[model samples]
Target: MKSYKDLSKEELLQLQAALEAEYEDAKSKGLNLDMSRGKPAASQFDMEMDIMDVLNSSSDYKTAAGMDCRNYGLVDGIPEAKKLMADMMGVANADNVIVCGNASLSIMYDTISRSMTHGVLGSTPWCKLGKVKFLCPAPGYDRHFSVTEHFGIEMITVPMTPQGPDMDIVEKLVSEDEAVKGIWCVPKYSNPQGYSYSEETVKRFAALKPAAKDFRIFWDNAYVVHHLYEEKQDHILDILAECEKAGNPHIVYEFCSTSKVSFAGAGIAAIASSKENLDDMRKSMTMQTIGYDKINQLRHVRYFKDFDGIEAHMKKHAQIIRPKFEAVLKVLECELSGLEIAQWTEPKGGYFISFEALNGCAKKIVAKCKEAGVVLTGAGATFPYGKDPGDSNIRLAPTFPTPEELRAATDLFVLCVKLVSVEMLLAQQA
Candidate 1:
């Protein structure tokens, strides 16, 4: 198959005409499909229907330590749950973890909120400082940027490499700028790109000597166990241990949640860090409430006993979601493979496939799809402040849609891509 870039002018015109006709025929189907948001499909959630039965009228309420989960005593979490989360996060012990609410995003928000008002570990509150900056890896999670933006923190966009964020730039910026207080990292199976950070990148993050004593790496390891193929799973070095080895024990605050593993809103979330970091966070948490919901934590531990059990459960998830991912990848590969107009990541895990179209074409493609009854993650959603500098990145979330719907939606997506790219090329030609 010839690459689109190698096509003659007449050939390009002929290809454009054929693709436009296909686009029109696809539009006539009146298909209403959505490939927006990395939500688990209803079928995936249905597999865990038994989770609701795990804790019911006839359930036992005592935790492994014999603490009554009905009471509000364990502010951090029950021992078993802490151990479960710790092991899942690849930490050495449960002592380094604090199990929190259902969503890690809330824990993340509160962490930033506390640091803004009260400071971290006795340092000056960020709000009191002249400028508070956070290093944001571009083509990254928008929610991470939204958290910092909500707090009025300046976000510096760092270019991302396939291995991870550009470490040389990270090391330099962190070491030189006192205002650079934090970095947002989705080290394993990163949100949209599904690229795990290499060991060297993790080591560099661990050894970073930030000018700000209160600086921290907000490590959101949301997809640590989310693999589409069990045989080809990617593993990342434990950042907490690496930081300790680098003599920077307080360098990172890692977070994880069973949002994808279980129900989105009802899953248990946890934060892992050094003893000192955990202690500092507890001071603020103590004033916030008596404790998080231990009942739900107990339910999770009872249902998924340990790391192995969790892995086994995730395999069931893989069974359901893997096909949807393949469905979209198949369409992209078959329809757009030789079209030099677009490039996309073939991620082994996580829920998103990052697509890069010709410069200034993503917004047009998304708009075109929306007009034909397909919804996509907004064109620039993968960047900070919702602005893709090149306006080329589009996040394809294949998880929530059914396979048939995914196929129909991706088919439209390809049509739109070809239509828009041809228009751009013709405009240049004229």
Candidate 2:
């Protein structure tokens, strides 16, 4: 019950010994559990098994408009799928949506790659420019950072507040630097933290007058419909709408997918942007391939049927995974509460809970957890280039494991936190 910081060297040593003994016992149990990614559990998939039967050999493959899904037309996406994705992304116009393959991350990668070679809306290609930069919100999504880094674009770290990335810094960076081309945002139920952007922040983003004409906000609204508590959901302002209202029609690209809503690897992904931006992307997409899997898109539209159906499906997801989240939170509260050595977020929705350990303690805690046969997303993975400057943040994924496995993993996690905290404190005493 005592804060680790208040413990004497002798008490810290004693506590460390007890936690180490517990660790050894845990290790001997051969508990090989992995919580490295926010993957849907088998049960979640089982619940949606009916999706496989939505289409069959006997079923018709024609769209409502009579477009044959078996053919190579509809380069962007099927009309029904676009409407669904557009509604999911809060984009008013279905014409602005381009449904892609299952991975939104891939679309994001192509966006960056296209910008590097062809540039945004006719600006000089990023590769040809002397310098290019992106604003990276820290304790943010690593894959977003990876895309920017891959293109050899410079990334500047922007601090994250609960409401969103610190907007003053964002506004300044965007306005003064032409090289600051874009910012990555999760907006709703953000990665790791599950923090949503406030209306004011969204307004500021839309209203910004950037130095570069091509500046953009890459809005990765992956968890827009992923809420753990149906009653306590976080709703963010529609960035695309706000941008248009602010006279910045082409300032954002919003992305969403049914990766979690249906099968993780085999669901539909989409991007919604201004007509001009969509047109530019269509030019490249025309050459990239004839089209994405139209049959698969048709399958999704048939399976979920509409935005309401998708919402109903996600509620089922929450029903299955919410307990896992609560289990982790209960253990954390029971074991680590008042232990001043750590802090963590209690997200109402989203796949992850962000854990902030004592300074210099995250890597060691993660290492200890892994040694005891429990795998976690590596420390610092939430940041750009996989570096958490303070070495203090770790992302806890509760969706992948069963409730029993999650409890065990979280138990070992807290044990490691206590043991590591004690060791850090003892070192300071010396």
Steric clashes per prediction: 0, 0
- Name every residue pair that clashes in candidate 1: none
**Tens digit per residue, CA lDDT, model 2, 1-430:** 8888888878888888898888899999888999999899999999999988999999999999999999989999999999999998888889989999999999999998899889999989988999999999989988898888888888899999999999999999999999999999999888889899999999999999999998989999999999999889999998989999999999999988889999999999999999999999999999998999999999999988889999998999999988998899999999999999889999988889999998999999999999999999999889888889999999999999888888889989999999898888898889
Q: TM-score for every candidate vs. truth?
A: 0.98, 0.99
lDDT of 1 at 403: 76
> What tens-digit string does per-residue lDDT give for candidate 1 at 359-399?
99999999999989999999887788898999999999998
Cα displacement (angstroms), candidate 1, residue 227, comes to: 0.9
lDDT scores in order: 0.92, 0.92
Measured by TM-score, how close is model 2 to the native structure?
0.99
